[model samples]
Target: MGPDDAFWEDGEWVSWDEIHQQIQYKEWRAKWPNADLSLVPVFEDLISVAEDYFLATGRHLQVYGDIGELYAAITYGIRLHKNFAQGSDGRLGNDHIEVKTIAPMNTKDQTSVKLSGHFNKLLVVNISEEFEISSRMIDRASLPKTSGNILKIRWDDLA
Candidate 1:
């Protein structure tokens, strides 16, 4: 299939309605049901931007990955650190947090999670094929030894 066809078939093209129905959105709402609705317009705008980029380039952007990280950071009240030699993605008080996203449907076998830098805590965000979101947090000290830069923990190990 052509890139455009593949992009569509792969479900990378997202709409505001689809995003709103996602598990991440539900989780956000459950936590902050009283949050102002004004934030939604910005989210809708971001969806449009992602869709436009895909249509013009026929390449799936990392918007969903970014969204996953942002969602996790906001939920945990963590601040995203700059990627300049930073070992972690966000900071929770004095601890470092590494956020990882997994879309099982997009992979044949997603085994070990990868780490870029040292972190005190690890957050695994799993997005299922149906857009259901689930997460887990583990301490770096409890994990197995690292092979090169990869953690020895497998996807099943986290379950």
Candidate 2:
């Protein structure tokens, strides 16, 4: 696992890439029984838009990134709950989740994991230069104390 793929799981660091790969493998097995989906395209248009937005604006667009988060939630069978506040990105089972995405290549600051309101869980999604994606799911209680609206945890802590 790369440094960027590290995430705390069961009190130990694990590779989000490996977890996601396992999920995908199980999904494929359940969906197609024995057939392979190697040629299937997943979020081609959205990924193109994300890449274009980053290239043109020199920053990661929130809407495009949110779309990626939504895709991840769906893939993992999480239900989305939209609201203006309260950090309601989606829900995994009974846990209220807040999804945050960052493209490491687009920003120099590694302390961008900001949060407001309340959430049971935080999902930090990291997108690499090659558009490879990984995520870290952290319980809000495990996070450090917040100052004002920002959570104490940063990108460096997760990445």
Candidate 3:
């Protein structure tokens, strides 16, 4: 195998979303034939600007949550509900899904999300310090019962 193949097989990945601006509308159409990807440019621009600002100032913009939601929708073929929709974020087939994103700048290392709404399944996403994104999906029934609504999805969940 080549060096690039070895790099990928070793469980390291580079973010392909870095080429967001380079894709054509037709390419997006081919990628998601059932979904409209017209807003890709806007999302790409927002991410680019945020990353640039963070690099220059070393402070994260409060945009990672939104990024995570968008990433989930596109990556997992979920149809999103309108913003501020109570209960859950979107639908995947017949399942109501909620998404939680862990930011790269979270120094505490521990992260938990408050599940205040109704969802059949949960998608926990994390952006590593290196900016590689990963996710874990859990059935609502599999999650541990907590007194509060908090779901403590540790970093190892992504591993």
Please name the candidate that would achieve the greatest lDDT relative to the true structure: 3
Q: Mind giving the per-residue lDDT tens digits that candidate 1 earns over 29-61?
A: 687564333344454465466666766876556
Predicted model with the maximum TM-score? 3
Model 1 error, position 150 (Å): 1.7
Poorest lDDT segment (10 consecutive residues) of candidate 2: 32-41
Clashing pairs in model 3? Answer: none
User: Of 1 and 2, which scores higher on TM-score?
Assistant: 2
Quantify all predictions' global Cα lDDT against the true fold. 0.63, 0.63, 0.74
lDDT of 3 by residue, 102-150 (tens): 8889775446766778898988878777666777888888777888877
User: Taking the tens digit of each residue's C-alpha lDDT, what string does model 2 give over 36-101?
Assistant: 334223444566677788788987655645554655554555565655555567777788777777
Model 3 stretches astray by more than 4 angstroms: 1-35
Instruction: For residue 70, give model 1's deviation from the true position in Å.
Output: 1.2
Q: What alpha-carbon RMSD in Å does predicted model 3 have with respect to the real structure? A: 11.4
Q: How close is every model to the real structure, measured as TM-score?
A: 0.58, 0.59, 0.72
Candidate 2: the clashing residue pairs are none
Measured with C-alpha atoms, the lDDT of residue 127 in candidate 3 is 75
Question: How close to the true structure is residue 14 of candidate 3, measured as C-alpha lDDT?
Answer: 38
lDDT of 2: 0.63
